[model samples]
Target: MSNKEQLYQERLNRYMTAMDCGKPDKVPVCFGIGEWAIKYTDYTFQEVFYDSEKANRIVEDMLPDFDVDIFSGGPTLWWPPMFDVMGSKLYKFPGIGLEEDNTFQYNEEEYMKAEDYDDFIANPTEWLVKNFLPRISAEFAEPGSYRATIALIKSSAAFAMFGAAAGAAAQRWAVEYGMVGQFTGFTKAPFDTLGDALRAMKGILTDLRRRPDKVLAACEAIVPHNIYGGIAGPGADTRFPCFAPLHRGAYPFLNPEQWDKFYWPTLKAVIEGLWAKGKRMFFFAEGNWTPYLEKIAELPEKSIVFDIDTTDAKKAREILGGKFCLQGGIPTTLLTYGTPEKVKEHVKRTIDELAGDGGFILAPGGVLMGDAKKENILAAIEAAREYGVY
Candidate 1:
């Protein structure tokens, strides 16, 4: 193996072993690569997207420079393929970057007509089986097809959501046509079908209060997929309760009780359902799951990975001790604004405090955005390698 590959493999082994609650050579350090790496390097987002050679080079460039234990697949922040399959148009900004916003637009007329649930369900499956699957299968049959296919799917999803349109048509279609059925199928195809439904904030909250059985059923459908195991639970970055605040006008109407009544129960079901499926989950509770920590802690111990973004890390550690693997506490904002010295000090302190027991993974509290400072990021990695050695 090449030196970079060898290093990545060694670190990955250590990380996987640590995650399994076994001793490794040390606590391995890994960060989710994002726009920060792309902007810091000379490569542009388009160049990375269009050219595999360049994308591979960029990841390889990061491996030794940062000593990241896990090498994330590039085009890290793109949309999924369901968007293009649903015929959403996309827009882009030359300088800023591609994200969910810059990637797609829903044909509102197409969606408005799709409000009929029964027709909605029939169209997507027929389209997928007749149009999408055959094309995708043939494409995958080509040399190096799987990687290419994943790239296309990821790009399509990223663009459709973030591009200049309202959102992807596929998201609308899923919500309109397949939401209930797909939500039901979550038990069978948890990863593929369960979370595909797109309920508006009000709709989901209402369901929680009025139709909780339906909501729980949806959660149950998706839980079986979680049983096969990877990272269990959900990340807060998506349109769930934890990330609702990030979108403008998403949660202004709801009082805390309403949020608790609606959002919290569904969130609870998602966690509990997956736990019942014999899998542990790591929740990247982005904002503050603090409001719901007690409820979250009610989950099975060490089965959840709670990565808190806007909460007190120290308090989270204390409350969630031996129950969940705490993954992140490092703030991306600090990694951008803080001095190198400050970054190093913060990482050292966090590891020293949180890593005393075994269940911790050193990472930025969220994905590093494209605009984060280069020196600050390097400092954080260096501190982890130096002080994070258990």
Candidate 2:
């Protein structure tokens, strides 16, 4: 094998072994590069959002310095212009209608009417194309109008061109840099899709009580798309594993009785579908799910990684010890404020305890934020180097 290929395989092996509840040579670290990349270059959100090539280059330049096991920054920040042209009710990207320097934000208004729930479940793709798209963007709502049609075509072309370029560049960088955690895919629980896109958050929560059956049906209905996501990706055909970033189904969000009825059933079905097709996943549990420890424990063994957020990951290790490969949750708050020594110390403690057995990887609890300290990020890598030995 070529030296480049060999280096890629070596790192890939560590993550593949780790994610399956087995020990690799050492625990792998995933760089949670979200807004942090934009921040790193000292670029304004407006500056980077407008210049996709420059923004991408900045991230690529930084990746080698940290030398993380798996490279991130998939589908990097390429917004603004499209929203500007289409008139998005969904997001406010910097400069493009949003006041200068303000970071992009979602505007989740009720795009779906309550009475339309059954139509959504019956044909999600058609409903989205026919109904959801039109409601949110003026361009889609008036497709036959010449100005709208021209604007839509131009903006979509630009968005696709940038997305394809960024994605390809990320993949190439991963291989050439010998990082190669090329596994990138996304599947939200059907309920989150229903909440984020259709019912809106408050609306969905209200519907859980007011129209529980429709909510359940909609969640079930979105499962096929979720499974398709699980079963297809760079991860599906290669060593990299597909992961599900779970949102909106944690402790205070839904009571256990409500969870059983609304969340777990559809989510489990999505996971099982992936497993049956010979795919594995890492479920990015996005909130404090300590209350549902036993319920999480019931998932089929060695088929997933549950990288937790806002919960005691050490306790999670004990609860899910051998069930799913546990992952790290380096609090961005601590990383931003603590000394480098303290950051390293915290990471060491997490590594020593959770990875003592294997079935663990180190990762940010959430996407690495723009404000996280560079020294602290370096310390996470240093901790793995110093104490993450098998």
Candidate 3:
């Protein structure tokens, strides 16, 4: 085998071993080139979001410099061209709605109303295509119009093109750079599906009090769909977990009782369903889930790689250490605000505290902000290599 292929296998083994709650030669370090990389280059945020080829090139340029095991992701999260074709009101991209350098802004609104709950619960797929699509896409506001027809055609084509390009990019990264992706498929908690884009935060919060049953029904309707989505990626690959960035289920977003009643059940169902198919979840628990760690422990052993954001690390190691792999130790804030020395210190302490026995990957606990310092990021990786040996 070529050198790159051998390197890929080594990194993959490290990740797989850690996922199974065992130690490899070293603690696997996950890294990503976020929008912060844009500042180091001449490209504006608009250029990167609209041009996938350019974004891929940007990532390729950065790859050789990063000596890490798992690649979390590339610079652009979504190709804006897809949203532009559909006239999606979901986000306002850099150049289209704001300045060329500005980050995209989520334009949250109650696209799915409380009254629409019954229709959505009855047939979720039909509801989304028929009602939700029009509400969220300005071009599709008039369902049968010429503009709407053209929009759907263009948008669907863009979706296919984006998927194909992403697959090619992943292959290139694996073959040429010896990089391993942390996960494959993408899904969200059923409640997030209903809350994030459908009901909006305010609307969902209000519904919890006035229309609790409808909220429950909507989440129930969404579970099976999320399960299907979690496994429907390229080749339905089960070697890696499916990415599920959980929102709303975080602490104090809903009180413990509300979270128990509304959030956990459907999300757990999605996880269990995926697990039955030999799939695992990258439970990217973004915010503080301190209250729910024990509850999260009830999942089948090795069903998830629980990510730590603001969730207490020591407690997570105690609750989930052996059964599931734990990822994330460096806080994103440290990458943005702290010095290289401080980042290295935190890395050493984190390895000592959380990764002593195994089942851990050293990575940033949350999405790295665009302003995160490159020096500190490099320091974290360096420290991980230096201190992570078992």
lDDT of 3 by residue, 1-390 (tens): 999999999999999999999999999999898888888889999999899888888899989989899998888889998899889999999999999998889999999988999999999999999998998899988889999999999999999999999989999999999999988888999999999999999999999999999999999999999999989966289999999999999998999999999999999999999999999999999999989999999999999999999999999999988999999999999999999999999999999999977899999999986899889999999999999898
Q: State the displacement of the C-alpha of residue 330, model 1, in Å, after optimal TM-score superposition.
A: 1.0
Superposed Cα deviation of residue 376, candidate 3 (Å): 1.0
Q: Estimate every model's Cα lDDT from 0 to 1.
A: 0.50, 0.76, 0.93
In order of appearance, the predictions have TM-scores of 0.63, 0.93, 0.99
Candidate 1 error regions (>4 Å): 1-10, 20-25, 79-86, 89-197, 202-261, 264-278
Count: clashes, candidate 3: 0
Q: Could you say which candidate leads in TM-score?
A: 3
Query: Native-vs-model 3 lDDT?
Result: 0.93
lDDT of 3 at 264: 98
* Error of model 3, residue 93, in angstroms: 0.4
Cα RMSD to the true fold for all candidates: 11.4, 2.1, 0.8
* lDDT minimum window of 10 residues, candidate 2: 232-241
Candidate order by lDDT, highest to lowest? 3, 2, 1
lDDT of 2 by residue, 1-390 (tens): 877678778788887787777788878888745665566566777887777766767766766676677775632445567666776678877776576566777788889988999999899999987788778887667767886687679778877876687668766776667766535566778888888878888899889879999998898889989989876545466345576767778778888898888988998888888777776667777778888878878878866678777877767988998778777567767877888899888888878777877888887776665677877888888887788788
Pairwise TM-score winner, candidates 2 and 3: 3
For this target, which candidate reaches the highest lDDT against the unseen true structure? 3
* Decreasing TM-score order of the candidates: 3, 2, 1
